[model samples]
Target: MSETRIVGLRTERGWTQERLAEVSGVTVRTVQRLEAGNDVSLDTLSRLAGALEVPLRDLVAERAERDDTGNAGSTDDIDDTGGPAAGDDAAARHFADAARSAWRDIALGVALLVTSPAPVVLLIAGADAGLVPTSVEVAIAIGLGALLAIALVATLHLVRASGRLSPFLPIRQERVRFGARALRWAERLEGVHRRQRTRATAVACAMWVSSPLPLIVVALIEPGRGQGLWIAAATAVLLVVVAAGAFTALRTAWAPYVQAKLAPAVEARATV
Candidate 1:
């Protein structure tokens, strides 16, 4: 098998390569190669253990330590040391592949969003450029398109950042030791996410309660266009809520699949 005992142990716990990288600051590729074999350089192994905050022997140990979970089941029964329990290997493999290709995906996504503005420019400068039949439609499209573009660009950037930061994300370990070899990325993502959501909910409620101050500002500046400005500002606020709420929901829901992927890595680290 390509994977070593350490890899299997790590998978049983759940952790992503990215998380391991973060805790260890080793290159993702190094994690990849080491997991594949027992032949890593001593210097690399020492650093990896140090980053995982564990002893070198813990990482290279050949057996599972006592089951603190006390579940009375072998590793296979709880979940395959092969992958996260939430999905079949195919699904886990998919995200792993995506993570590997993250830079390319982000690059493509950005290129598309950046060039999206071209269509509007074409409409304005081409044969149909002179069609000013309804200013309102053009204006509305402009507002929505701009907002959509902003959202897309922001989303793509976020994807790239997450991919890069994933190496060291924590997985569900018995404990977050100074030296665990997290095979999984995050164990308590849902709990962490819930706390953040609560805070956001409070902030949103506060903003909603004080919603009209922008109108006052615009009205003071320009009586006629004040309502439009206020409406736009309100739309922006609503967008923020929707986006934040949606991300929170996904974080909680997809927690299983994501956590599953990294679980082995985390478990591996715990022992290593």
Candidate 2:
């Protein structure tokens, strides 16, 4: 094995240096020094191997090879300046994909919940204004039925999305850890997403705060002319705009939110 194989193994398993340190009962600096191709004790090597569930020889192979060749500067040896191992990229991609899925599910489910009452509100208002042929009592019944149906659908949607996101939840991913390369990647992605999320949230808030404008505008223009129908239309529009805004904000913010939530875990691991 090459000198950087320890880094390879740890990263391939999605274990950060700090994670390895915690599991192996060593310091994070020790893990870092070892990966930098610095010499460490046999006991440390044994602990690492055990923590990684690999044989001790796997951890010592590079040292053995170097001793045999009396080569301290072999080309295969990794120095502090070496680039990250291949596993880092794969881990980062996996994390990105997972976060994307989680956000999509969350946004869609909440959007459904938010907009579920729009149709019912419109139907009742239309009936009250004689805009619909149905009697007010029948319209109320239909609206109630529609409300129940939409609520049920929203519940199912949320449950299904939650199922799909279960693996990425904090409790399930508690033991999973990220390396420095992955953390840097996450930070960069978070920075880009933070801007998007902030913009989305601002837009959403503006939409929500302005949603009542339609009703006010219509009432001021003509107080009694088709007032019921106009009020219903305005309410329906408000629900839709608010739902859209919420979905946009949630979708854009999910990546940053997830990354922030994981920060404390990394910090704890480092201090360990």
Candidate 3:
């Protein structure tokens, strides 16, 4: 069957290939192939029809009618209003979800990293105070270490998963070479254009560098006679700076993907 009908129907409904694949429980690559006019099984067609909320016969019939009418045009054409195509909007929504998911994963990983050391510290303190038996403490320490290792691995996985969605986000190249390499690999997997990757890398580096400035300023400031007050002030500043930096990083990483998907609409508005 001709794929134009499927493409046309999907676009008309403002659905991206990714969105269709998700709703249809099919792989994105498979959707891409099917839309490229590759032959697919009836089961695949049925799934797609269900996802599109159309009957299988209607899909086939639409294609036949379009072929007979010879009114088919390129999907890239803008509408009469000069706005973005529905497919563009669909893409924007899909990537926006990915961006949100990536940030959430990052946040969860950070939380894991911050808490993973607590159990070890607690166990050591308990043993010193004779609250924990020496033998039991040793076993607990070993188990805690293993748990920490597992948490670290899970955190790294989440970070890598986020990198796949937001290839522009810095994965701490200086501190984590493996993570930086993973980010690069993810960028390639996501088919990020070379130009976009270069631009994103530059922006990410700038953001990462600037993010620490506030904390540095706090550190450099001379603490007056009240050492406790100074420490509290510095801690508060560090917390605020870290929170703001994380927020900025998330926004910066997500912006390009969102903008790329929305560019047509933005350009249309500008021309109008």
Among the numbered candidates, top lDDT falls to 2
In model 2, pairs of residues that clash are: none
Worst 10 residues of 3 by lDDT: 168-177
Runs in model 2 lying further than 4 Å from the true structure: 1-92, 170-173
* Model 3 per-residue lDDT at 20: 86
Candidate 3 lDDT over 169-254, as tens digits, reads 21111101122233333345345544544565566456556645654665677865544334444444444444444443444345
Largest TM-score belongs to which candidate?
2
RMSD of each: 13.0, 12.4, 14.7
Q: For candidate 2, what is the total of clashing residue pairs?
A: 0
Best of the two (2, 3) by TM-score: 2
Off by over 4 Å in 1: 1-36, 39-134, 161-201, 212-230, 233-272
Higher-scoring candidate on TM-score, 1 or 2: 2
Prediction 2 global C-alpha lDDT: 0.67
Residue lDDT tens for model 1, 170-264? 22222222222222334455355557546655654565555555545555664452344344554444444444444333333333444554665
- Model 1, position 20, has a per-residue lDDT of 70
What TM-score should be assigned to candidate 3?
A: 0.37
TM-score: model 2 vs. ground truth: 0.63
Error of 3 at 71 (Å): 18
